[model samples]
Target: MDFDPPSNFSPELMMRDAAAYRPLFYDPNTTFYNGHDDQHPRRFNEEVTNDWYDFLDGKLTREQIAAFMLEGKKVAAIANSSSPKVKAFERFVRLAHQVDNYACTPINPWSYYNNPQSDTPQKTSEELVEEAIRDYRAETNAFLKNRYAFQALKALFYAGNRDAFERFFGEVEPNMPRNTLYYRALGYRAGFYIEVKDFCNANLLYAEVFNHVPAMRPVAATSLTLQDEKQWEQCLRAASPEQKTALWALLAFRTGDNDRAIRSIYQIRPKDPLLSLLVIRFINENEGRRWSLIGPPTKDADPKANHMKEIPRETFDLIRRIASEEKTENPFLWYAAAGYITSWSGDYDGANSLYDKAAGQMKAGNKEAADQLRLLRLVNALSRITEVKGDNVERLTEELRWLYKQNSYPGYGEGGMRYKTAIEQSATYLSTLYAKAGRPELAEMLDHSSEKIAQPGVVDKLIAVLENPRTPMEKLIVDMYPYTAEEFYFYKALQALHADQLIEAEALMKKAGKQGMTELYTNPFNDYILDPLDAHTRKHIKEAKVKYTPITLIQKMREGEAKIARGEEVYNNSLLVGNAFYNMSFYGTSDIWRVPLLNASIFELVPCYAQEMVMTSPAAKKYYRMALKAATTDEQRAKAVFLSIKCDRNDCYLGPIRGRALCDDQRYMNQSNSPNWLDRDGFGELMRYANTQYYRDVIRECGYFQLYVAKHKR
Candidate 1:
């Protein structure tokens, strides 16, 4: 995919003038391009005329150019060579990008060979099988020790020569060595068996490979082996110490035993790619978004219970400790993991350096490794750059966009397919960043570029709402991917309000209010009702208030209780006690001056309490006296008054009245189920007044408020 220059962005200047644009090189020192230090900058050699920038600018004609990510904070000798090996290394790097970015199988004619189609010619299955068998027989006799036996076998299997395959397999099955042909054939057969649901055969093939070459078990164990616990236990018993520990950690994680998973993962000494990936995902599940093949779980029902912004210090230290050790063949995994850990820990500089190291290692090694690492760095960088301050983040984001643009892997080849996906996701994320940075045009373009990219139906549309606001908001709710039905309704109501459809907005807001507990923090009536209402619209809003708001019901219930109660003073005293308890619990002292520190003041509090008690208490007492005027017995009057006080107390605790709105607000239960301001204060006010028999009875008896409590209790 290509980037079209937005009105604000200049492609020509970005290409020609280095000063006009921030360079994408991995810098090692603090050099401020726009008043913030560019992390891990790569220097352009004075002698080397064909730098990466020159290549991108089309000034350099060379097919390959040497690019360096400075090693640590020091300069390294540039390996300037154009040998075949160097060219191969360059292709490998591009291949890595292709594979990592476009992570899906390529659709090609070869894979479509089974289909009968003809501009030229098509062979029948029987004829293909006959040819394969003839080739196998001739080759076996002519070259008894042929290295291409697996290829012949694969062809025969593909052509439906099952009998021939069986015979050939019997001949080579017992003695096949642990090499490319053997493992490749084993993998193919295992996959075939799995496709056929022949678990028994698949298990045997996987076991043979695992037992013979444990280091290569990742290919086999990547599938769901844990479904059959007995077999998994056998595989576990046969694994090396490092592999065993990693497996244990993964198993523990899958089963929701985080403490054990952490303990087992810490036991792993050597670097393992699978383990690194698992650990990064595990950490992500805790800190950021949960990664799942099925996409993220519904926002409210998020699988991760321990949602936090930062991981434990020990977790970060362990990852860094491993990253700092001797570099392994798969050092990119450690580097990427360490980068993610630090990034999550708010150490963007450290993360940038670690990613630079990983990129450098990838440059030195194979493209396959580099590809995955590149995307890993991109994801971490995009997420972390948002948290970073200054103009540097913008510069970095632009550089990342350039990187994505320059690394386009074309064609429908396997590498290209995966690279396409990589670019799409990367571009989508970039669009979000652009949107946040007030570059909506660029964001829209990037989002459009990724329209062909397959994503979860819900999340994709949620993202679409941000990218394409011109599209009707109603069209974006293809099932409300990240939010609950009620949340969607609430969001939709807000959208309607923005569109000036006040009646529709009010109706939708009422609909949302009817679902679960209506949030108090952001009152739809006040906060979302942006414009002044006309008489007709005001009527709709009034109807909405009567339909959705719980204040009326609570007041009526209070009035009924007041008409039967004996002593209104007793309830007032109880309320005062509850207020005092809340004040002491929240402020940590009874000093009136300290109350202002609670983001409120005593000046407002005294009158608020006085007005609340004096005005209401008298009316309630009058109602109680009127209801009990005919009571000939003291017992009846006492019982009537007792019930009245309970009703008033219940209102104080759980009613959606003016003062206790925050206690039942649904915003606290937003996507991550993270705590809000009320949670921070220990929900002291609600806790002090709620949980009494009165409050419990009101919630249990009042059908309207039962679901509200269930949905928003936490």
Candidate 2:
């Protein structure tokens, strides 16, 4: 039931610093096609309109121009629009819409295979394609001509006229500017190669698109499929040197063989920006692989159980050598990565040397780089500690303080910097250290659990340390402890109250201040034990006429016990005391706030507290027996016997065999096949007063008692 929050092995601070290589490599999603940006189309439209605004000499606001294109308004509809640029755009819009009519309806695979019918008539599709081609040839403005050429090729490609599409691309590509639109046309050509089964050329052209256009990388990478080494060699031979390096980069990203790809790309071009992304990605993958080894220590946990894989020696040497050479575009990135890898491999001193080298090479004013190096240094420092002595604990005081401060940083997880993994790992490691150092109370404070603190002396030790912390280690323990001293006092008071230690419970509750004075909705001495699952009981408790705080409830029960001690109204006073204890048990409606660290709303109690809460209430049963011993009439005897039977039934159903059946529905099922209820202590006594009104009421209302009576009479 104890769970740590989601923590990243690769720091987002370092990965996001490679901003230029994003949306292609080192993207957070790392999917085959990085589609994290759903607003790409809207942003693309904005970019297009902004360019148009600049070209038109600010004839209209950018929003207005975008709106004009979005609305598809005709030129003649505009008032006082005599500008030549406006007229040219109007013609372009008409042709663009014509192209869209053909391009928008791609051949749906399901309909094409199932129906084999064209949605648009063949004659109409041919006419639209011809109109686009004619517009491209007649347009005189250079800007409009380029747009027309792209639209014409798009229309041909979508019309299924591949011969015309390829022929027209050849004619226009030589004259077209190498922009996003041109790269898109090349993507279409790549698709043609795919359809013709010329995969080598297809991959070659797709690599070009992937390298040139950042936004188009997803589509290009998705389409670039070199199935085998033969096709890969063919593409390599056909590609230019720059494209060949792009091919290796794409392969590295797709296959995660950064060692091979980095070497290949480095031999080709040492200053390539893509090399930095590959190095970061390689480090991140290895970091994820070795996360458990470097993470918080676990008691009795095998280091080889969860993660046993190791980084290959050759790969480590290659990265370390690359960092040593300092020929990469970002030497600091390489050094930091190599150093982190070295540190996790147990080379603390070597890792520190690499970290110092990285610090020297880090670019000034780069906060991300600075934080990354600091985090690495902290990792190295913590890894250097083999024991939890005073000196070892004091050595990390400032770093531990800095790590704690990151929890409140505005961009702890997603934006500014990521240190959550480091924080969790450090806390776990320190908890283990304190445990090994014979300070289990401090260990439980760092990595806390209700089960551990529920042990006999843990809470007292925690309180003792909080009251008088004498050493630096003890002070740090108090500083890092999550609960306030008052909260521990309240919890300890609740434990004492449950164990029938009234004097100790009262004194501890007094020390708990307002925390121990939380008001209860129902009277604790109510004769009938309310069921939490009953709708009427839930409503009645909310509107109860009487309420008592914990202090007042204990005082009331203490007064009843005092009267019994003085031998005044023994039966009545004893019954009232028994009722108060019963109302605070797990079977009672007012039981929610009775036990500390137990979630009363849940149907079953947690294992550590289940025995005390549900399986037994010796205090309630003991007082009920006193009431039975002092009863003067059959009615008083019947009432005491029936209440005592309620306790017996709870203990039988929730005891070892049945296992925590606290709810009425579960109790009914569990008791159906068993004769155990007939043997409970008070059942025979209740049958002795079968003629009493209390017994008659029990027979009418209680099915199990009614079954007992029928069996006995037969």
Candidate 3:
């Protein structure tokens, strides 16, 4: 088979090829803005070849969408039917990663939201303020192409990158056209001044913002310090009749204006029962009804009770609707049924899809999902009804038998009931199968199988695995998994107390250690091996205490890139950062334990700097090119799609890049990307209404697939 195909292939395989060419594109969890993995270039775009009009027209047929669903030729039909909009956005996302000069890209509905560029770098704070003031006057559209540029400039202002921010602002301001949201941008412009701690300018900008954009006063007020509080309050009192209302409304909320705050909210959305409910809920959630001695005496219990008692009429209506026959399956029921069915049906793919869909419906912090998809494989395997994918059932059985024969014992761990039960059932099945096969040497075969199945000397290991302190006892049990003798030794080291006990166990483990089991015995917790004879010896003690300090992905990728730079070409994504993390240390958990926590503070930092490498590193490019060239599997193709998509976005990837920037900066993205519907603002209902329509559109299209050109190679 050809290791890599030329670009001139059927459109059916184009997405696959692009995916193989750059594996990052198809990652569902990994999102990109205009390509390059959200990393911005330090300099200029190297591959500025295409004008990329195809993205605007949405004419691109991304065949990879098919791979996500069905396999092979079936994908081609799906790709052909996809609308120009889907294709356009996907292509834009891919191109934006590498594209520079966002201004040159064709104007589309989304162009207004696209990030803009600075014509020149400003060098002073005065220059920035002057330029910002001009832009604030010019831009009429609340949304514009320069929004991201403004945002970037705003960030630099906060970072104290004053000169650059100033220079950047100087270029953007004079030229931008005034539009509906121009005042809103000006309001943001004022906020930018505040971020740099410039009070005089901030007040001027805020004055202008209140003059032009009245509703944002409360939001702006929250960011002010105690020193500026009175001036703001005074400004609130002295404002004109128009500004006075909004100004005092915000000040009143700060100075015990609960009624105005409530009224102000009512003015925005006249009958938001949810807002009313939450006001009461907040009182209950934070125990807010209690009054301090500085204010009034408290009857906290009564308010708390009243807050609970005053349920909204809308809520009652919702409670009824939820219980009644709704056409859509309740998220809980759908997931639970899907999980339960997938478990024993050998429908791993289906089960995984169901769980993903369920996750989309789940509320934040809600842990009790319909059912976890984790147990799907186990359920499927046990049911023995769905091993259609390459005869895994026969393979798993034969492999288990062979493993037992090699060990000469198999009852294995008696630790967890699950583990013990699995081993026992496995042995019982093999015994029955062999006995049923019936041969002249059946009795001898049965005896040999029984010896192998008994799990020779495995009780101690089970006890070691179970005794660990963590609720996840599995973390301490290494070899107990996939059941083999070497695992017994790993568990012995982790659970052992006295050096003598360790030494004795060490000898048994070493004697038991065979060729395939050696990798498992290497101390997953520590760097060096433990020989029980010298467990207490200073040398052994010092060695055992050594644990791997995790290094950044950049360092590992640099090493790989350096090798590639030197023309050493054995590069694999798994062996790169993926393997670096994978081999870091598992201690006793599953292989997935090595992957960083998705929402963890540090783990979120991991993908941030990847953008920089994409922009600056030739080795990184070479590696990516080779990876895309070599990718053959559907999973590999998916990764390629992600990388390519990142490259395709017309702007350098900033979000992930900056997120990585703030990784070591020890910052978080406090600015939320939550859909506009969640806020209590008037726009919230409109957003919800729009989203409802969109969702309904999708549901109407659900299982309502349209056929396109049927041929794959065409």
Residues 1-714 of candidate 1 have per-residue lDDT tens digits of 233111111111112222222221111121211123222122222212243334234432333333322111211221354444343334333432332222222335664566534223221255444443454455533222233355455554554445566677777666555554576567657666776776655655665554344333444444434567676667566666654654664454345444445445455544433344344334434432322111112244443543443356666676677667733335555676677566555566787899888776564655555555555555555555442245544545443544555444442211221244345555566566656765554454456322222122432344455334442222232222233444445545433433334456556656554432332221221211111123532332222223323222223334434443545554333333222222111111222112111223322232221212211223333334443454445443443343334334323332223232232225323323221222222223223335355445445444433454464666
Instruction: Give the runs in model 1 whose Cα sits over 4 Å from its true position.
Output: 1-205, 210-231, 238-321, 344-346, 356-394, 397-401, 407-714
Runs in model 3 with CA error above 4 Å?
A: 1-228, 232-714
Per-prediction TM-score to the true structure, in the order listed:
0.29, 0.84, 0.21
State the displacement of the C-alpha of residue 130, model 1, in Å, after optimal TM-score superposition. Answer: 21
- State how far residue 706 of model 2 sits from its true place (Å): 7.4
Order of models, best lDDT first: 2, 1, 3
Least lDDT summed over 10 consecutive residues: which range in candidate 3? Answer: 1-10
lDDT values for all models: 0.41, 0.72, 0.34
Task: Count clashing residue pairs in model 3.
Answer: 55
lDDT assessment of candidate 3: 0.34
Report the lDDT of model 3 for residue 626: 62
Please report the TM-score between candidate 2 and the true structure: 0.84
Tell me how many residue pairs clash in candidate 2: 0
